[model samples]
Every structure is written in structure tokens, then in C-alpha cells.
Target: MRQPVTLSSRGFARAMRADATKAETLLWQALRNRQLNGLKFKRQVPLDGYILDFVCFEAGLIIEVDGSQHADSQADVVRDRHFEEQGFHILRFWNDEVEKNPDAVCSAILQAAKGRG
Candidate 1:
């Protein structure tokens, strides 16, 4: 079973959800409601001081919608390593990709979750 989230992390997650990006909002619409392969996904989930854009716990997957700020980001490298160390598989997509090609994004997500499913 997963550990309970700290109050601070929970609060931060809530804030992130409220302040979600356009790409995040777009992806969330498709990922929510089990619209993708009957898999459940959570948005703005907090983990180890980081808020993931979308996470499917059952699949041990983390989906990141990256904006311009994330281009060549060292912080992201570190963050990815940390999550990978904890057995989470991450899939990153550009903001424009999510907005312009949602179907492809969904397809990639579905492919990644295939192993888990």
C-alpha cells in the first residue's frame, strides 16, 4: 500500500491543480474518467517534493507535460532519476505536442501502460 501524503504536499498538489497549464488541462480532459484503456489517472499528484502532471499508480507511470521552461532542464534530469529509482516509469511530452496532437500523446500513454495492463 502507498503511504499517506503529507499535508504540505497535498496542499501543493491542490494548488497545482488549480493553476494547471493549458496543455495540462487539455491532457487531463482525455486522461480523466478512465477514457484511456480503463486506466485511472490522477492529476497534480505529489511525490517526493514534486508534483507530477499525471500519475497512474496502478501502472507505476508518470506522465509529464513539459513547457519551454523544461527544455534541457537539469532539474528534470534529477527528478526523473529520483522517480526512476523508485520504480516509476515516466513519459514526457512537449506542451505543444499535447495541445496539437492529443491522439498521439494518448497513444503513447496507452503504449506505455500496455506492459502494466
Candidate 2:
């Protein structure tokens, strides 16, 4: 599996400033600097031509903060399939979920990291 190159400091700071979704910000707060179970995480991470909202390489996790834009389940399923094929286990959470019940959202992510699937 090929890992994407790290972004330059300027590029990363810019990306972080770019309009981040609510769930994206919430997850980043939880995953930064070994915050969650001492696992390091990166946000707006480049993978191929796309950027994942959050990724923890140690656990092979990709967290996608989906909003109403993903109401279409069929397309989401297809997209998830592609990610799975690339050896990524994607965990999606709605914006409201993160804003209202961030504890629950983080719990789900931690569960996913433990190979709950």
C-alpha cells in the first residue's frame, strides 16, 4: 500500500483553515497529537487525488465527515467500496452528530479502530 506524501507546513495550515465541516473539526480535536488512545492522526490528508477528513495510519482508518450531501446512500456505498478496495476502513459521521453528541461519535471511531467490523 502506498501512503501519500505529507503536505508542506504552509499547505497543511492552509488546508486546516479552509472551511472545515463541523464533524471534521470535532474529530480533529479528538485525534490530534495522540489524543485518542495515543494514536496519531492527520486531517485533510491527501490520499491519491482526494483528501480524507481524518486518518490514523497506525489503525488504517479514514474518517469522512459527511453532511446532507451524502443523503444518497447508493453513491455513498459505491464510494465506500472504492475506499475499502484501497485498504481503507471508512467511518462516516453526520455533522449534527458530531456537534450534538461528539462523545458518541468518538466512541464509534474508537470501536472501529478495534476492528469491530
lDDT of 1 by residue, 1-117 (tens): 355789999998999899999999999999999999999999998877788999999999999999899999999999999898888899999999999999999999999999885
Return the TM-score for candidate 2, rounded to 2 decimals: 0.79
The lDDT of each candidate is: 0.93, 0.77
Q: How many angstroms is residue 110 displaced in model 2 relative to the true structure, after the best TM-score fit?
A: 0.8
Q: List the residue pairs that clash in candidate 2.
A: none
Give residue 91's lDDT in candidate 2 (0 to 100). Answer: 90
Give the lDDT of residue 7 in candidate 2: 61
Off by over 4 Å in 2: 1-13, 73-75, 115-117
Runs of candidate 1 exceeding 4 Å displacement: 1-4
Q: Say what the RMSD of model 1 is.
A: 1.8
For every candidate, C-alpha RMSD to the true structure in Å: 1.8, 3.6
TM-score top scorer = 1
